[model samples]
Target: MLVLEGVSRRFGAKSAVEGVELSIERGSFIGVIGRSGAGKSTLLRMINRLIDPTSGRIALDDVDVSALRGKELREWRARCAMIFQQFNLVGRLDVLTNVLMGRLNKVPTHRSLMRLWSDEDIAIALTALEQFDMGSFAAQRADQLSGGQQQRVAIARALVQEPEIILADEPIASLDPRNTKLVMDSLSRINRDYGITVFCNLHSLDLARAYCGRLIGMSQGRVVFDGGPFDLTEDVARQLYGLEAGDVIDMPEEMPAAVVAAQAATPPVLAAH
Candidate 1:
């Protein structure tokens, strides 16, 4: 489990995150939705100790995280995968090698600098690419692929890390509809197949409603909403994001057949634990 206790991150004169307190259960898929500059990114960064909190604490499985540094911190970071809005793959590197970079934590820095990737690591990365339907592009340079395919390579890279927690910051912000669906589907698959705890910061409500079990809304560096999708009403969204909630969700084509089928078979809302 992940726990945040009165976590506050101050950046110079501003509080990027103010007194954040929440608990994330194992295997839960969560989405953080907010307007730009709402501090969603800062909050997620603190969870992985990417940035230090000016006050309060973060714990994973009851162990304080901010207290760790150096090797210990590196190890923790390896266990928590972070993906950015920009697919951060090496443009010059092929997709396979890009994904293999995820294994850097287990390899010597010298080997990495030398570009010495083992056959097994290469094979694992290829498998991850296959999982995301980007296997055919594995031999292509990351820059050679389209934005959607590049994002898949990024996902493959994260998979190579074998992380238990995946944190994504506006992963689909740069994609078109088809690409967004592709990326979101990959994220959904990992969350379901591996039971990895997926935490994402997104602006789209439709994607969150479709993929996440829990939604967290932040505004002015504070968490104002935490609940199931149904609880994220229009008023709540406007209060948190300052935009009409309906305006935040894009309707793609007709409603997806799979979503329609699921809605027919599944309850409209899953009860909160």
Candidate 2:
């Protein structure tokens, strides 16, 4: 389980997050939703230790995640992997090599610097790429792939880390509608198949409603609502997004049958826990 107690962060006079308290169980698929500047990204960054909180505590099971430093902090980051809006991949490197970078924390620094990836590690990377249906692009340069494909490579890299939690910050914000569906479906599959806790920061209400089992609504650097999809009524949504009923927009149309058929046709590629 991951617990946050009175967690808050501030930038000079500006507060990013304030007095947030949450108890997230393992294997849960949660979507953090809000308007821009609602502190959604800051919250995820704090959990991943990419940023420190100004006050309060963050704990994963028995460990005090907020106090970790140096090597311990690096290990924590490895365990709680992060995916971003921009797919962070080396442009010049082949897809396989980019995926292998996830194993850096597991290998000696010198070995990583020398790019000495073992057959076993290569196999692991390959398996991850296969899981995302990017196995055929292993030898291709990351920059050469389309946005959706590059994001899949980024996900494959995250999978190779064998993380306990995935903190995705606006992962699909830059993708087209079809690519958005593909990325979201891939994330959903990873959460379902691997039992990894997923905390996705999403701007699209429809996407959150479609994929997440639970929704956390934030407003002005504070958690305003926490409940399931059905529990988030129109009034509650208005309060969260500060929008009138007519202004609320529906997300792109979903082709459920086609998505299901595609998923069914793909060969199942299981990750090693």
Candidate 3:
């Protein structure tokens, strides 16, 4: 379990996050939604120590996450992998080498710097690519792939880390509808099949409802609601978005045909628990 007690962050006179508290159980697929600057990204970054909380504590399974430093902090980060809004891949590197970078913490610094990976490490990386149906692109440059394909390669990189928790900061914010569905499906599969805890920041209420088992609504640096997808009624959405009821009532319910076709073309691979 992960616990945040009175967590808050401030930049001089402004507060990014304030007095936030949450208890996240293992294997939960949670979606954090809010308008821009609602502090969604800041909260996720604090959990992995990417950003320090100005007040309160963050704990994971009874370990004080806020207190870790140096090598300890690095190890904690390895266990809690982060996926960015922009697929953070080395464009010039071959897909396989990019995936292999996940093993940097486990391998010696010298070997990693020289890109001298063992056969077993190479096999593991390849297996990760296969899981996402990107095995054939292992030798291709990351920059050459489409946005959807590049995102899959990013997922493969995260999988090779063998992380206990995955924090996705708007993983599909930049993708087209088709690519969005594919990426969301991949995340859902990872959460369900591998039992990896997933905390994602999402802008679209529809996509959040479709994939996440639980939704956490934030407004102005505070949690406004915490409940299942079905519990997120029209009123709740309005409150979450800081909009009038009519603004949210007209939201789309169905996935695009392109997204459906993409999903059909690539059935998600269930990761081994």
Candidate 4:
């Protein structure tokens, strides 16, 4: 389990996150929802140790991850992988090489610097790409792919890391509706099949309701609601988004034909899972 106790972060006088307390179980899919500047990204970054907390503790399985430094910090980051709103891939590198970058923490510095990937590592990277239906594009440069394809490639890279936890900070924010569904489905599959815990930050209440087992609502850097999706009442949502009483949240029903075709083309390796 990952536990956060009184965790807080201050940027000078401004508090990005404040006194967050929660316990996340293994293999759970959680979505953090709020309006802009609600500190969802800051909270995820604190968990990954990309940003340190000004007070309180973060722990995974009884280990004090918040205090870890040097090699321990690097290892913790590898164990807890992060996916961003932007698909952070090297434009010049081939898809295969980009995925192979996940193994850097496990391999020797000299080997990684020289790009001396072993056959075993290559196999793992290939398997991940195949799962995401990107195996055919292994030789293609990352920038040449469409937004959806690039995001899938980024996911494959994360998969190769073999992480216990995936911190996705608005992963589908930039994609179209079709790609959004695909990305969410892929993350869901990973959580269900591989037992990897996923913590996703999202703006769309409907998407969060569809994909997450648990919903955590944040407002002004503090968690005001944490429960199952069904427990998120309209009143609470109003408070979370700072909306008026009668204002309705837009819930669009869309499943593009392209999404169906893409799913059909996804390899059986992932479909079975």
Best by TM-score: 2
Q: What is the lDDT of residue 230 in candidate 2?
A: 53
Candidate 4, residues 25-123, lDDT tens digits: the string is: 898888898888989999999999999999999999979999999999999999999998888999999999999998899799999999999999999
Q: How many residue pairs clash in each candidate?
A: 0, 0, 0, 0
lDDT of 3 at 130: 90
Residue-level lDDT of model 1, residues 1-273, one tens digit each, is 899999999889987888888888877788998888889999888888889999998899967888988998998888889988899989997888899999999788999989798888888988898999988987888999888888988988998899989999899998999999999999988988998999999988888867777888887788877776655566666676564666797545554555443332112221211
Evaluated against the true structure, the overall lDDT of model 1 is 0.83
CA lDDT of each prediction against the hidden true structure:
0.83, 0.86, 0.85, 0.84
Q: Residue 105, candidate 4: how far off, in angstroms?
A: 1.2
Q: Tell how far residue 126 is off in model 1, in angstroms.
A: 0.7
Candidate 2 Cα deviation (angstroms), residue 104? 0.5
Q: Alpha-carbon error at 238 in model 2, in Å?
A: 0.8
- Cα distance off (Å), candidate 2, residue 178: 1.1
lDDT of 3 at 18: 90
Candidate 4 ranges with C-alpha deviation above 4 Å: 244-273
* Error of model 3, residue 81, in angstroms: 0.2
